[model samples]
Target: MARVPQARRQFAAKDRQQARLCAEQRPRAPPKTALGVWGKAAPTPAARRVQDARAHAANCNRSTVVLKRRGFPMMAPGQVDLLKKRGKKLGEGHFSTAVVTRWHGADAVLKAPRQKPNVGQFVKECGLLHTLEGAGGAPEPLGLCLYPLAQVISFAGPQTLAGYLEESRSSAELLRLAADLCGKVSEVHEKGIIHNDLKFDNVIVDGRGQIHLIDFGNANPQGQTFCLVSKGQRCPWLGPEVFSQHLSSPAQDAFSVGFMLDTISKLMP
Candidate 1:
C-alpha cells in the first residue's frame, strides 16, 4: 500500500477516538421483553381494576380509621351542616370558604365549596390533605362531607403569611419563617406531591410562630403534567415553566420558595 501521510494517520486516530467516545456516551435503549419495552408485563383489565380498587380502599380506610385514631373523627353530614350554620367564616377563596369551628372540642376549619361546580376541587384538596396526614407543617384533614360538599381540617392558625408580612418582623423571625416554609415544601415533596400554590396566602403562621402550609387545592402529584387556568388574575408565585410546559415537579415549588424569600428580604426593615 502507498505510504499514508503522518497527519492523515493522526486525523484517522482522532476520528476513531471521537466515535468511540460518542458511542460510550450515547444512551442505551431500555431492554425489551415479551410484554412491553419497560421489561415488565402490563396488567390485564381485571388486574388493573383490582389494583385501583385496592388503592381506593386503602385511601378510604386511611382517611377514616387512621384519622380517627389520631383524634380526628369522621364527622356526620348533619354535624358538618350544623357547623356550617354555626361556624364563623375564617376566609373565602374562589372555590371554597373556610369557616372556623369546633370539631370534637378542638379547633377546626370547615372548608365548603362556594358553588356546586367546585365540589370536585374541594374533594381533591381533602384527599391531598389526607395523603399528607401527620406530615409536619401540613394541616390534618379530619374528614369530608357530601351533603353540602365540604371538608373539615385542623385549624392551622388565624393569620396567613400574607397578613403576617404586613407587620414589622425582625430579621431572625423572617429567616425562621422562611426556613419553616422551605422545610414544609420539602416535606410535601418527600410525600411525592407538589404544592403548586406556594404563595403567602396559602401559608399559615400559628401563635407559636410555626409555619404551616394550607390550601392544597392546587397541589398535584409530583411528575404529573397539569395546566393551570387563571381566574382573571396572574399567580406571581408559580414558576414560568408552569405557563409554558404545564408540568408539575419539585423545581416549581423551589421557584416559589425563592420568590417568597426574595419578597421577605425586600420587606425586611
Candidate 2:
C-alpha cells in the first residue's frame, strides 16, 4: 500500500472511534427466557389459544350493532333511572349485580357490573348469551346497556336452583330436575360454548319448574384455555385438570354437571 497521508490517517482513526462508540451504545439483544425472547416472556400455548378464542369472540360475536339490527337494541343511560324506579335487586355477585325490572313492558333482568372496570366481563357474558339465543335452558338476551354497562336479559325465574333446593322435593322430583339440568348443559355444549361456571347459583328455576342456565361471564369457546386472570372464587365443581392445565373443554362442564347431580342426590330424601 502507498504511504497514507496524515489527513487521511486522522480521518480513518476518527471513523474507527465513532464505530466503537456506536457499537457500545447499541442495545444488545435481550436474553431469551424460557417463556419467550427479547426479555418478554412468550405467551404459552394455552395462553395463545385463549387469546385467539377471545379475539374471535370480540371480533365476530361481540358486536352490539349487529345485535341491535337483530332486534336487541342497547339500553341508554337515561333508561337506567327508569330501571331503578321499576327494578328490584335480584342478587349481587363479585363482578355484577342483577335486578328484576321491566324492559319494553316485558319482565327482564338487568345485569350490570359492580364497577365500570368490570364491564368487560359483562360484555363477554352478553356476547355468549346472544350466541345462545333461541336455545332452550338459557335466558333470552334482550339488549345491552352502555353508560353503566349492563346486559338486559329475559327474566329466567323468581328463584335460583340454590334457593329452589331449599324447598321440600321428593326424590323423584330431584332426579327429574337433575336430568333436566344435564339436558340443558348438553344443549349449551352443542352450541360450542362452555359454561365454565355451572352451579346451582347460576341456574334459574321458573315457577313452572323450568330450568334456565345463566351467567356466561366465565364462559369460553370450546378448546380455549381457562382465563386465569379473571378466574372467580374457588369452585368445588371445577375439575382438577382445569386448574392444573388451564385448558377448557366440554369435559370440564361435564364434571360440573356431575358434581351438581351428586349434590342434588344427597339432598334427596
In candidate 2, what are the lDDT values of residues 63-149, reduced to their tens digit? 655666766667777787678778999889877888999988888888877755465566667777778874647877777775556
Which regions of candidate 1 fall more than 4 Å away from where they truly are?
1-74
- Kindly report the root-mean-square deviation of model 2 from the true structure over all alpha carbons: 11.0
lDDT value, candidate 2, whole model: 0.79
C-alpha RMSD by candidate, in order: 21.8, 11.0
- Model 1 worst lDDT window (10 residues): 66-75
- The 0-to-1 C-alpha lDDT of every candidate, in the order given, reads 0.80, 0.79
Which residue pairs collide in model 2, if any? 35-42
Model 1 C-alpha lDDT per residue in residues 36-79, reported as the tens digit of each score: 55658777789899999998777666656654665544667798
Model 2 lDDT-worst window of ten: 226-235
Error of 2 at 75 (Å): 2.0
